[model samples]
Target: MVHLPNTPTREREIKLSFLSIMDIWSWICELPNLDDWSESPVFELVSSGQADQDGSTQSVHLRADRTSGSESEAAVIFTVCLQGFPPLNAEKPLWVSEKCHVSRENPFLPLIVQLVQEIIALSPNAPNSTCPRAQLQKLKPEPIAWVMDSHSLESFSTFFNLVFILRLFWLCACDAPNEAGSLYFQSLLPSALEIVSSSPLPVLRTFLVTVGIDTELCFMRTLGYVVAKLCIFRELGVGLQVLVPPPCRSPGFSYSTEAHGVWALKGYASMMTMMKVASSDGLKPQIPRLDAKESVLKYALAHQQLEALVQLEYSVAFNDGFIQVLARIDNIRLHVAKLGFKNQNDEAEYGEEKHFPSRVRIWVGPEVGATYVGGLSLSRSTGNAEKEVEIQKIVKGHFQNLKLSKGKAVARTSTKTKMKNWRMDQEAEGNGAIFDAVLYDNATGQEVATGRPYGETSDDPIHGLRRRYVGANRPFTKTGSVVLAGDEYGEEVGWKLSKEMEGSVLKWRIGGEFWVSYWPNQAKTSFFETRYVEWCDEVDLPLIPGKMIV
Candidate 1:
């Protein structure tokens, strides 16, 4: 059994060998604060031949751990540094003695390997960074392992590179082996969360600028990374809510210059796609509605913007990435389609699929009710008191032809033949079907409106007697007499006035509707004014024959 040295007293001036000074100097240099001292006496002795052991053993007495009572702790403070000192003047072994060797491999080698592997596996979860390298690697096999075998479960480790440390942290943080592993890394989870929620914007931007990288792409990627980490990671989900503060309204931003806008836009686009993927399992943020369809469309479109930018910026004009992005966007569009808001045109009566009752015309007099001419009775249902008046106006106009009923009653004309023929041709030619019905009145010599079978049109401009409205399927046909119909009476009167007076003109009337009338009157007054002016010149107010609004 080996004997260890006694602990020195606090104020003792104990004699020290040169090697003992070296031991003290080595320990001091390892101190974080004293690492810069290159000219100490211990360093000088090592540099020169004065303290060289030259294969001869030398005893180095060290005065250390004067305050420590524990032998194990005192050995750490005083003895280990000099443990490697070699003998002085001991004759070196002959170089050709390999044939006389007892064994080819050392038995301690396997122990060292196992020790190192254990250290690496456990050190990631260690509370402190410090670990004993010699005990793990068995660098000098003579000294006993510092801790007892049972306690040596606290494996040895060394400093690792930042990237490796981060990788290891993430790899283990995602899943733990046992209760101890889980408990040990529980403290580390919050630190990772803090980093995930932290804004690297300031530093990242500056770094990109210094490296001459595209700032827009950098910013977008940085933002995307933050969003992904916060939104998806189990540890960071709650903390992220605190980090990214929600804006009260949309902060509309536009680039004044093109310097690096394309790259930035691409990053935005990529992140959005990533967001969809990470939150695929019902963990995504709820996007609020904004002013225009284009605003949200722009957000969706931001991903594609980068593709365009790449083509424009690099002049490569390749499209593989763009095609993949388009496929992703198509998926997003399909999701938006289910919301039913983006498919406004699909619900429309004309121009596309007929979603409502079509060509619902009824001459309402004392004989017909409001439901036949206008729509289902609002007065009998959830009717607003104010909308009742508007419904009444529509009912009155529907039956104004009561006086002309006995004279030359207009025959209700339907486009059954034309619609049927069109459908037949569509089926035969493999073209999409046209479900819109064109209602006409032979006496009035004009088409009433375009409608789907299920949709109704109060008055569509499809039959208007104007140059722009002059198509083959137009509402109006040439008539011998200009007798006005119910809907066209005002325009006919204006037309008669214009013909009789050379300077008279007619214009379309436009005004507020029931729901948003107050808002339009307050904020959108200018739009109403401009429309009124155009209507006045074109139809209401008289215009000189040679003069026009343009």
Candidate 2:
């Protein structure tokens, strides 16, 4: 435990009261591990009005014990007696009551009920024994109902445990196994949602990101379990406009850092699953889903964005408001994921670019061994469909320019070939090497043209010109005829030429989507690219923050 300095006037008072509480518990309990409970059940009983008739009496007695350590033990003993057995209630010990007086506003009773039920369900007949972890699966309804109704942020028991209690409450509210319990749980969902949304506790919010990369809560696993249970809140319009709060400005491992990643991924997955279920059951909601973007997808690729990904990756982040950055990154990722593929891969293919004039090479799936289907798709003109017509006009103009370039190249090639053939004829009587002739519209530059003469003789032929010429601009022509027929006198005119061109067709096969693909195109690898540039731009590179991933 980190020791904090005692500076304020009330600091000593706090220390004294805390020590007295410990002493009281030490004297009254002797069952299991004493260290396990930092507090006494006796204190709980008295504070709730089950023991003390008046709150002031308990405070005074606790106060007196601080001033008189061992020297006035008798006086301290007397005060305890006065508090525990006021003459009017001497028959009852200081901590006895027929009914619990825990305030309905206090979160303690409901949390206690949850903890107790968790213990009972796991431990069964063992009244005083701690429950085993395996049996404490999901939370029970009684406690969730109590907490939902109470909805107070006051930490009556372990301030740390309040998050867990609320989390369990939300989980039951969303996923109670039975209708009897679910109906009651559903009724409390709105209240629970309100409590979480309005509460400013960082722990409470991070409790929704089960990954616990956010360091606010002391115990990682406990906080994670709490966060993993927010499926119910998500279903209740927990979009950016309603659920995520403003950024937190505090330092240290806060919830906002890791939460954004977990929430976006889980929530998106859940939403998709629910959509599938609703489609099958005919119960879909009318709410429109936002498309996921590459930038947001980058965030969900959890391991990569952890510090910036969550926050620990930056040394400067330790200076201030790092939690806010974490929250921003998270919300952005969530928003993108919510948008679905529309936000990520929605760019329009324009003009001849859709046909991929240049041969393209793409890997299949995420692995190399996964074989790819490769073929070329050509652009073609449509007669009257408005959009396709406009696109074809643009493509035709571009193809005309390409034809000119191709024609010029062919003219140059033809001249070179004729000279070589003339030299060969003079040297060897033109019997051995015959020059095949063809024409292409290679004009002013490398671009092909509107039209060209093409042919292949049985002898020497260049690779690009020898095969069938599929118009780079209009490969799939509406006329459905071969573009350039070979002058070969084969039985099947240009069919063999077409067969030879098959290998070069550019194929566009679909790949499985990545979270990054849901955001901006370059977002996956570039979210933190500028940060790195800034870091390197500094005269000295900072020590890789708190902990480096590797």
True-structure RMSD, every candidate: 31.6, 27.2
Summarize candidate 1's per-residue lDDT along 178-288 as a digit string, tens digits.
221222122222233233233222232222233232322323332332222322332223222322232111111111111221111111222222111111113223763
Model 2 CA lDDT for position 356? 8
How well is each residue in 1-550 modelled by candidate 2, as lDDT tens digits?
1011112222111112222322432332222232343433232212212224353322112111112233322121112112323334322221111121222343233333444344223221111212233444444445334433443333222222343234334233333222212222222222333333343443333333321222221122232222222332233333312323311111112222211112121111111111110110122236624434422332232111111111111111232322111111111111111111112222222101110011111111111221321221111222232231111111222345554533222111111211110000001111111111112223211111111112112122122221122445432232211111211211110000122222231111111111211111122211111101000000111212343221
Residue 463, candidate 1: C-alpha displacement in angstroms: 33
- Candidate 1: C-alpha RMSD after superposition: 31.6
TM agreement with the true structure for every prediction: 0.19, 0.22
Q: lDDT score of model 2?
A: 0.22
- Global lDDT of model 1: 0.21
Stretches of candidate 1 off by over 4 Å are: 1-168, 171-200, 209-550
Candidate 2: give its CA RMSD in angstroms.
27.2
| Best candidate according to lDDT | 2
